[model samples]
Target: MTEDLTFNSKMAAVYEKNTRISIPTYNSLFAMIQSYYRVQLGEKAASLLLIGAGGGNELSAWGPSNPGWTFTGVDPSEEMLKIAKHKVVELGLESRVSLIQGTTDDLPKTHLKFDAASCILVLHFIDDVQEKLKLLGSIKDKLKSGAPFILVSAYGNHDESELQARLNVWKSFWIDAGRESSEVDEMVRSAITRLSLLPEKQIEELLAESGFMKITRFYSTGLFAGWICHTE
Candidate 1:
């Protein structure tokens, strides 16, 4: 989690592979999100903020289908954004997609309100409760009221028994999914010790305090969940 928001060359190269091995239903979850946005936005020419848009996955998934929609993909990792940029170019979406190498706070304050936003698998890296709220608040500030925001991250009850049970199952899933034992052990250790996973209820409370409402969980597997929230 120390480098979850930013990635080195080696980590970036293996991210797609390792993520598939570790996170169950990784591609399917993205597909569901794409469907949700497309159905919700219709033919409207909307702008989207892809907070922590690493590897350009969101742009690649959402752009070609919604040709009218534009995206501002922000991330702290230059290496990750490099791939996203190349993907945008390859998809010939350079005209509609803007890539920025910075955190959400570094985004230019614009009168242009986003029609929707997504912060996926990003915020848990910031363990500080206040910082997490601040980050969500920043994203909320950019969105128009009633705009849907998709947020997905690892979260769980912190009880020792619950965490241990889930951790063991998660570790086995990774190992069974072809990850080597050493790598699985290391990842499980990091998840247990380094990652800050607040309970689901606490996460929802923070979101509500950050000005999101009608939070709906659409996907969940292992301790990870995805939600569609509205700024109200």
Candidate 2:
């Protein structure tokens, strides 16, 4: 299996524990985005594209109240897909959801179009800012005019000191577990690198360059939480 799959498999096994903290934060973020879209679009049901959907926790957050919406979730990890599929079946959301194993690059070929799309907490994991921009551009291509695109990523200059402090603790633990120094270094490098954490002005500039209009920061929390939306 690919290293990405290996890492995601390990993550899937432990993601529930991680979500104890992440879910609440992301849930609130998505909720605010949804409210904004509801008011702006005036639609109860939306066709949503979720890039790097992971275990489908975002769908669960939307809940049964918004039965009009349908989600097409895409991720690159088979292991993560397994977890998400299981949750979809268990929650009886199979009818409202479709899970695919791929990245944002594959969306256009999937022949799917969406009224709205979100890439939350997924951009930083991508190592290339240009590639991430290409993916966002592809989403814009698939959306109809006036459709909304929501993006959330770690914000640059928000509070790197805190993240760096946390990474130090994580690095020590990984080393104590007998991981090679090189492996630990790679982990630390990934954590500290902020591929999408450009300044707020820069983010808006990039969004405009990608053919999106009316870009705005919708929410933020420390350096970790950020939300921006634009229309096609």
Candidate 3:
């Protein structure tokens, strides 16, 4: 069986295009998020923090639309950041966008408090529940009080029937996107066993414990869920 794609240069080369095809409601989900940020923070001089800011897709979406919003995008993957940097340069957003090749904890300590933050399609990669909480906590620490946070992730407890059902649908989504049967099976297997996804309840608990409030989900596609929250 083929291994799951890692965030290396090879995957980074085709990441943008492949993700657009593989993930359901790919465009609209991010559109909603950017629109929400625009309406919610409108004209306010704010710095938006992006965790797992791979390829600067968020920057590309939000930068052109909201000129007042500056972005600090952090990701552990250097290859991914290289692609994102290129995008930033291409967009002529170098003046407004900052890319960091590290996790949130690696973000430089400063008096700068982010007014908004996002962690789209991330967090689920962490296998340990405590580590997930720590990641969220680290994000919370960087933001100002009452700042909005958008989090999107794939989730479902492995032991539950609901997770199994969602996994079936999720794999079908890939297959429908034109992936071969064997590839889909291997991808599905990796997602189920290799990825560390949590149940909704535990995720909520982790968010709450990490100082996020008003945790409400605004979108869901198969096993993936998008949440709008606040750091308070």
Collision pairs in model 2? none
**lDDT on C-alpha atoms for all candidate structures:** 0.83, 0.70, 0.83
Instruction: For candidate 2, give the lDDT of residue 24.
Output: 38
- How would you encode candidate 2's per-residue C-alpha lDDT over 115-141 as one tens digit per residue? 888887777676676976787787788
- Compared with the true structure, what per-residue lDDT tens digits does model 1 show for residues 94-199? 9998888888877887648899999988978887999999999999999988999999988886665876777777788887877788987887676656887888
RMSD of each: 4.5, 6.0, 4.6
TM-score of each: 0.89, 0.74, 0.91
Query: Using alpha carbons, what is the TM-score of model 1?
Result: 0.89
Q: Rank the models by TM-score, top first.
A: 3, 1, 2
Candidate 3 residue-wise lDDT, 69-110, digit = tens: 889999998877877877787688999988888898778887
C-alpha lDDT of candidate 1 relative to the true structure? 0.83
Query: 167, model 1: CA deviation in Å?
Result: 2.0
Off by over 4 Å in 3: 1-13
Off by over 4 Å in 1: 1-13
